[model samples]
Target: MSEHHELILTCPKGLESLLAEEAGGLGLEDVREHTAAIVGHAALEVAYRMCLWSRLANRVLLVIGRFPVTDAESLYAQVHAVDWREHLEVAGTLAVEFSGRGSGIDNTHFGALKVKDAIVDRLRDAGGLRPGIDKLNPDLRVHLRLDRGQAVLSLDLSGHSLHQRGYRLQQGVAPLKENLAAAILLRAGWPRIAAEGGALADPMCGVGTFLVEAGMMAADMAPNLRREHWGFSGWLGHVPALWNRLLAEAQERAAIGLARPPLWLRGYEADPRLVQPARNNIERAGLSSWVRVYQGELATFEPHPDRNQRGLVICNPPYGERLGDEASLLYLYQHLGERLRQVCLGWEAGVFTGAPELGKRMGLRSHKQYAFWNGALPCKLLLFKVDAGQFVTGERQPVARDTGQATPARLSEGGQMFANRLRKNLKQLSKWSVREGVGCYRLYDADMPEYALAIDIYQDWVHVQEYAAPRTIDPAKAQTRLLDALAAIPLALEVMPEKVVVKRRERQSGKRQYERQGSEGHFLEVREGGARLLVNLTDYLDTGLFLDHRPMRRRIQREASGKRFLNLFCYTATVTVHAALGGARQTTSVDLSKTYLDWARRNLALNGYSERQSLVQADVMEWLEKDSGEYDLIFIDPPTFSNSKRMEGVFDVQRDHVRLIDLAMARLAAGGTLYFSNNFRRFALDCRLLERYTAEEISAATIDEDFRRNERIHRTWRLQAGKTR
Candidate 1:
C-alpha cells in the first residue's frame, strides 16, 4: 500500500485541465485529465499534499482497487477480495458511495449497500468488533465508480468537500462555491498579480468567499490548513511523521508569506446584513489583517487602491431565476459594467453569472468567456480588461431593476417595508396567476394609506398610478412617499426601473383620463385569459387594458362562445378581444373617439378577428338610440362622467345610468344577459330598474382577489328581462 498509489482528484467540470496542471506541479506524475477528474500516480504523501493544498478539488481519492464485475454478486465478491483490515479498524465507522448505473445495478443506493455488506462481512470475519455505519463524519468513505462491466474502488482522503474551507459556515443567498472562486481567481490570473504584489477586490462579495480565497492565495496559506478533520486521520495506513513534516513546511511558508506587507484586498457587499458575516469569514480564515469587508453598493463601489495602482475587479452579480426577474437584472449587470469602466480603468475584471445574455447586456466587450456549471445551472465567467477600448459607452438602453423570487441585494428602509408588502402580495397571487394563465394583474392598490399608489404588473413591466394626494395631507410628504413607492416598485417586482411607468391619477371628469400622457407611443403585448392585447404604458394615462376588469373579461370569455356580443364604451375594445377569442359568433363595439375606434380596429386584428366584428364611431348614448342590432351577450363599463365634445351634455353615471341601461337593454335579445358596471364610487342603483328588469348583483363575484382590498374600484350587475317583484 506504500510504494506508489493511483490518485484521482475530482473537481467540478471545466476545471480538469487546471486540476491536472496543479496536480503535476505537486509531485504527481503521469497525470491524465478526464471529464471532472484527473488521474495520476503519486506517493501517499503526494496525495496528502493535495488534500491539504489543492483548492480546486472536490475530493482527493486514493484508488485502492479495480476489478471486473457484471452483477451484484461479482461486485460484492470483488469488494470482499480487498483486505479491509488494512484501511478501516474493526471499531471504526464507514460509508460507501457508488456512482454510475449499469452492470445490472440500476440504483446507486442498492449498489452501495452491496459494497457495504461485503466490506462488513470481511471485517467481521477478521474477528474483533465489526465497523458500525456512519454517513456523516465517517472515519472512512469508500467510493466505487461503475463503468462498462468494471468497478474502480477508492478511499476518500478528504472528509467533507474540500470547498468547505471551514470558514463559510454561513453564506449569502446564491453564494459562489469556494473552490470555484479559487479557480475563477486562477483563471483571472490572480496568482501572477499576487506575485507582482497586485491587489484584488469583489464588489458583490457574498459572505466574503472571493475575498477570503484571494487572501489565502496571496498569503501562500494552504486552503485546508485550518481544517481539523480528515479522511486519513483514522485510516490504518496513515503515516504520522511524514504528514507532520509536510505540515511544518506549509506552516513555515505561510509565516513568510504573511510576514510581508499585505496586499490591498477589499470587498464591498451591497447588503448591510452580509457585512458582519463577511467580516467573520475573513477573520476565520486568519487573514483579517490583509482582507477587509465593507457595506457598500455597486453604484458606490470603488476599490481604495493607491494612486498609480491597479487591481482586478471581480463580482458574481445576480442572475435572476424567476419569471419577470431577469429583465430587472439587466440593470444590475449594466451597473457593474459601468462601475468597472468608469472607476477601474486600466484594470482587469471578471464577472461570473448564470445568465450569459444578461452578461452581454453589461455593455462591455469581454475578451474571453469561460463556461462553468453551478450545480445544474450553466454559467459564464466574463473576463474583461477594463480599458477605454473595451468599454462600450454608447448610449445604453434604459435598464430597469426588478427583483425575483429571491430578495434583491439592497433596499432603503421605506423601500424595504413597501417591498415586503409587495412581496407578500406577489407570493399570495403568483400561484393563482400562474394557474389561471394570467400574465398581468394588479399587484398593489394603496394597501398602505400613506403610499397611495396602485401598482400593476404587465408581464415584466410595472405600471404605477399615484392617486392624487388630498388637501388634508402634506403634498410634499405625499410626493416623497410616492417617490419611495415608485422606487420600490421596480426592486420589489423585479422589473427595470425604466419599465415602471408612473402617472398621477385624479378625478377625471371628461376625456382627461383618455388623453395621451407621453408621445412614446410604444406598445407592449400582454396576455390574459387566452387573449393578447397591446398596452401603451407610457402614452396613455391608463394602460390600454384595465387590470380590475380581468375577472369580468374572463366571465365574458366563458359565455361568449357562439353568441352575438356587444361592448359599449369600449375605450380600447379589450373586452371585445376576449369575447372574440372566446368564440363569439359576432361582436359590435361602439365608442365616440376616432382614436379609440382605430385602436379597437387594431385590437380586433390582433386577435385575428375581421369580418364578423364591427366598430361604431358615434357617441355611445347617441349610437345606442339608432342601433337595431340584437346581442345575446352585452357588457357596458361606462366612465364615472364624460364631458367630450361628441356628447350633447355632460353625462354622469349616477344621473344618466337609468337611461343608458334602458338603451343597452333595448339591444339585448330575449333571454339575453346585459352586464352593466361602473366605477362611480358614489353612484346608487335606481329602484326603478328593479321593476323594469331582473337584476342580479354581481359586484362581489366580478371582483377578484386582487381587487378585493378596494372593492369600491367598481360595481356590477347582471340584468335580464324580468323584475324581482
Candidate 2:
C-alpha cells in the first residue's frame, strides 16, 4: 500500500488537454492526457493550485489508487484494502460517483452504492461509527472511473463540476457549460491572443459566458475564485496557510497582469433581457472592469472605435434547430457577412456551430473546420480569416440543379397513400391560416407520412424542415425528398448562391453538387392548404425556412387576439405576420440589421400584413432600454449566437435567456404573455430566479413533424405578471 503511487485526475471528456496544461502550469511533472483523465504526479501544493486556477476542469483529483477489478466483490476488496482512516473520518459524510463503460460493473448507481457500502463497512469495523450520507452537500466526493478491467479511484478536490463557475447567478437557454466555454477559448488560441492584444468576443454571448470566460482568462483570474466549497477543505492533508499563500500569489499575479488591459473582450446580444444578466455575470467573474457587454443586435454592429487593433470575433449562432427557420438564419448570416467584411478587418474569426449548412451562409471562406462534440451532437468549430480587401464581396458561382436520377427505393402504394394524406392536411392548414389572415401557416403535410420534415407556408416563402438520423445511409435521397416536398408547394425553386445546405453523415466519394442558381420560378402547383396563394413547389431541397415551430405558430395564431405585439430579434417576421393576422393592433419588429428588417417586411408583404407592421433595425435590448413602449404580447426568440460589429459585442441565447425573458416581461402589459423561445437542446429554465413571473414550459407545444415527437425544437414558456419583491 505504501509503495504503489499512481494517481489519475479525471475531467470532462474533451478537456483532458486543459487539465494536463493545468497540472504542468502548476509545476506537476509528467502530465499527460488520457481519454477523459489527466495523469500527473504532483505534491499537495500542485493539487491546490490546480483546484484554484483551472477553468476547464470539473474537479482536480488526487489519484490515490488504481487496481484491476472484474466484478463488484473485487471493487469492494480493492477499496477496503486502502486504509479508510488515513483520509475520511468515521464522522464525515462521503459520496461515491462512478462513470465507465464495458465491464461487469455496467450500472454506475450500483457501483457507487457498492463502493459507499464498502467504505462505510470498513470505517465502522475499524472505528465503530458509521458516517451519514449527504447527497446534496457531501463532506467528500470520491470519483471512480472504470475503463476495461482497470478501476482508478481518486479524491475529488474541486466540489461539484468546475464548469459551474460561481460567476453565473443567472442562466440562459442551453447556455454553454463554463468548462466547455473555457475549452473553446483554449482551442481558439485565446490565451496567447489575449497576451498579444487580440480582442475576444461572442456575438451571441448568452449570459456572457464566452466573454466572461475570455475576460477571466485575459485578467488571469481563477475560475473558482467565488466558489467556497472544495473537496480539499474536507481532506486531512488540507493546509490553510498554504492555501492562503497560494491565493495571495494568484491575486498578486492578477495584479501584476492588470497594468495594461487586454484589447476588446466584448459581448453583444439582441435581447434586452440579456444585457443586465451579462452585466451581472461579468461583474461576478470580476471581469466588469476588463470586459464590456452591449445589449445590441449582431447584424448591424460596427467595428470597435479603435482602428489600430484587429479583433477575434467568435459566434455560437442559432442553427435553426430550436429558434426559427433555416432560411432566416441564412438572412442572419448574410448580415453577419456584411458586418464582418465592413468592420472586422485583419482579424481572425471562428464560429462554433452544430450546423454546417448554417455556417455556409456566413459567406466567408473557412480556413479550418474542426469536428467537435457540443454535448453528444457532432459540431464543427469553423475558423475564418476576415480579410477586408480580399474576400469582402460575398461572391459565389451558381451550379445547375441536378436532374440526375435517384436510386430506386421501394415506396409501396400504401406508403404513397399515407404521404398524400399528410400532404392534404398540410394544404388544409396552409389555406386556413392564409385565408384567416395568418401570415405564417404551420403545414404538417410532410410529417404524417414518415419523412421527418415540417412544411410551413409563408405567403411568398415556403419553409421545409428536415431531421436526419445520427447515421444516414443515403443523404442524397434525404435531400431529394426534402427538395421534392418544397417543390410540392408549387413555388419555383430559385436556389440562392449560398442556399443549398448539405449535412453529410459521413464523408462520401465522388463529386457532390451543393448549390445551384437561376432555376425556373415555375413548378408543379398543388393547392393542399385552404389559401389559393400559388403553391410553387420546386425540385430543390429546403431553402425557405425551418418548420419545427409550427405549433408555436399555432400558439401565436391562438394568442394574438387584440394585442400589441413586439418581436425581438425578429428574423423575417414570421411571428409578426401571425400576430398581425391574429388581431394584433400594431406589430413592431426589432433586429440589429436592416437586412433582416428588409426580409421581415418582405415576409409581412407576402402575407399581406406589411402595412400593419413596423420594422426597427436596432439592437432589441438597447431599443427596449431606451424606448418605453409596452406591448400586450412579445415574442423573444434570439439567435443562439451573434457577434455583430454595429453593436458593441456578441450575444448568447443560453446565458441570456432568463434575463431576456425578464426584460420582455417587464415591458409586457398587465396580462400579457412574453413568449420566449430558444433552440438550445439542453436549455434549462431558471424558474426560481424568475419567481416574479408565472412560467410554464411549452416545449411540447412547439414541436412539429420535422422534429420527431421526442425531438424538442425550442424550450418555451409563457411569462406573465412581474415578480413581487
Candidate 3:
C-alpha cells in the first residue's frame, strides 16, 4: 500500500462542499467535490485524522484499485488479482459492499457474492485458510462501485460511518442524523458564531443533535474519539505507529479544548420524555458541562439569562407529513417567528423544514436558503437575521387587539354584551367541568345568535370555532365582530393568547369538512370518562376527540365491559378507546379515513390499551356488508354526508340510515345492543327501523350538560333485536 493514497469521503447529499472544505482543513491534497462525496489525495495520517475528526463525513474510504470489467467473470478476475495477503489475513473476517449497476451486474447482492468468492478462492489457492465473512463486524470492509465497464474498489477505514459519534444511545421521534445535523450547523455558520464566543440554542432540539454537534465544534472535539472500533484496526496494511500518533494528538487537542471556558449551549423541548434523552446524549458526548436541555414549550423559549444572548437559534421543527399536520404547523411557525423577533432580537435563526410553504408562515423573511436532503426528503434551511426589521406581519387577518392586559374588547357596546354572555356561560360550565372531572367541554355554543361561535376548552387551551357568517351579512362587519369575540374569549376565559386557537366553521357538502385549514398539527391530551384522548384544536374542523360525543363515549365505557365492541365510521375511535378501557373483551374500529385511523391508533396506544384493539381502514358500509362475525355491542356514528373519493359511493346518513342499520344489525349478536348516532341537524329515524327492531331514541340521554343548549348537535338511537313488523 502506498503512503499516499486517493481517498473518497462520503456524506449525505448536498454536503459535498462542506466535506471538501473539511478535507482541505485536514491538510489533504488535491481535494475535489463530487456528488454526495469528496475525492482527495492524502498520506495515511490525513486519512486517520479524517476517520477520527471529520464530523461531516459518513465514511472514509481508501481506494485500493480501479479496473475495467464487463461481467461477473472479469469482476472476479480483477478482485482476485489483488494480493489478499497484503490487506487481510487468511483467517480474518471480511465483508464486501457493492453498489451501482451496468457491465451486466444488475444486483448488488450477486456482485458482493462474486467479490467475496474471488477473495476466498485467492486465499485458498495459496494453501492458506479461507477468510470468513462477518457482515456485522468484519476485519476488512471492501466497497465496490461499478459504473459502465469500470470498477473502483476501496476499503472502508471508519468501520461504520463516521456519523456514529458514540453519543446518541437514545433518541426522540424522527431524529436528525448526526452528520446531517453537523452539515446544518456548518451551513448556519455555527463555527464562526462559536469562535466569537456567542451562544447556541435549539428550541425544538430532539435528543440534542444540534447542541451536541455544536458543542463538539466549539470544543474542537473529534467526533469519533469515543468510538473504540475502526476499519483499519485489524487490516494488514494499517500503520499502527502513525495511527497512534494521530490519536494522541487528537486527545491532547480535546483536553485543551475541554478545559477552555464552555460555550453557551442550551436546548428546549416541549415533551418532557425527550428532555432526558437529550441530556443523556450530551453526557455521553462528555459535554454535560457545556450543554443543557430543558423541558419547555415554544412560547416560553427564550435565551438563558446567564448565557450569551446574541448568537444562533437553529431548529428542525416538525414538518407536517400527514393529514391535519400541516394545518397545525402554521401556528407553530408563526409563534416561532414571533418569539425570535420579540425575545432573541439579535440572534441569527435557521429553520430546516421539508415543507417550505410552512416556513413562509414564520413571518420572517429568510435572507438565505440552502437546499439539503434529509434522507429521501428534499428540504431547505431557511436562514433569518432575527431583528425587528426582519419581522413581517403574520398571515392571520387583522383582529382587534386584546392581550389580556388591556381593557377587554367588551368595552364597546356590542362587544360588552357579547363579553357578558361569554362570562355567564363560563361561570355555568366551570363548575360542571370540575364536578364531572372533565378537563375539556363545550363552554359556549352560539348562545346568542348575533355572535355565533362555539367555544370549547381543553385544559388550559381554548378552541374557538366561528360559525361562518351568512352571505347576506356585511363581510367587514362580520369579521370585526368575529375578531371581537375572539379577543373576548381569552380574556373572559383567563387563558393566554398563545393558547387560544381559532377556526371558521362552515356548512360543508362532500369532503369540505376534512379539508385542511392551516398547518398547526398540535394535539392536546384531555381526559373524559377515564380515558385520555388527543384533541387537535388547530388542524381540522372537528378535534380528534369530539366534545359533543362525551356522553356517548361515557355510555360505551359503562356498557362495553366483557363484550365484543365494534365502532363504525369511527373518526379517531374515541368510543373504541373508552370501550377498551372499560374492559371490553375485544374491540374493532373501522373508518375509511387513514388519517383518523392513525389518530385512533395513537389514542388507543396512548391509554395503554393495546392488546384487544384493532383499527381498520375501511368504509364502514362496505365493511359491514362483508363482516360475518357478530359483535356483542356496536356503535355507529357516520358523517352527515360524505362523497369522499375513497368511498364506494356517496353517503347520506338521512337517506341511508335504514339500510345502514340493517347491515349493522346483521353483524350484531342476538340480544346485542347497537347505538346509532349522527350530526344531521334535521334527521328523523325511519319508522321501518322501529318496526324491525325494538328501537328507542336516546338523543336526549346522550346529550351531556355541556351540549344541552344545542340538542340538535347530534341525535342517537339504541336498538335491539325483536319481532318483525
Tens-digit lDDT string for candidate 2 (425-485): 6565655555545554455533544455555554445545465533544765554454334
Residue-level lDDT tens digits of model 1 in 1-725:
66999999999998899889888999999999999999999998899999889989999999999999889999999999999999998889999989987889999999999999999999984445699998988889999999898889999999889999899878898888899999999988899888887889899888999899999999999999989989888888888898899898888888998998999999998889999988898888899899988888777777764646888888888876432343346557756776766567778889988877666546578999898888778888889987767755543233234522222224447767999999999999999888888888898998998888888888888877878898999876775576456556776776656586677788786888988766766889877777879888777778779888998999999999999999999889999999998999999998888888888898789888889899988888999889888999999998887888778998889999999999999989999999999988888999899999999888998888788899988999999998876
lDDT: which is higher, 1 or 3? 3
Going through the candidates in the order shown, the clash numbers are 8, 54, 11
Model 3 clash tally, residue pairs: 11
Superposed on all Cα atoms, the candidates' RMSDs to the truth, in angstroms, are 18.3, 20.5, 10.4
Q: What RMSD value applies to candidate 2?
A: 20.5
| Cα shift from native, residue 306, model 3 (Å) | 5.6
User: What's the TM-score of each model vs. the native?
Assistant: 0.62, 0.59, 0.65
The C-alpha stretches of model 1 lying farther than 4 A from their native spots are 125-128, 394-673, 676-725
Top lDDT hit: 3
Which residue pairs show backbone clashes in model 1? 400-496, 400-497, 401-496, 401-497, 402-494, 402-495, 403-494, 694-722
Native-to-model Cα distance after best TM-score fit, residue 591 in candidate 1, in Å: 30
Residues 507-526, candidate 3: write the lDDT tens digits.
99876887666576778888
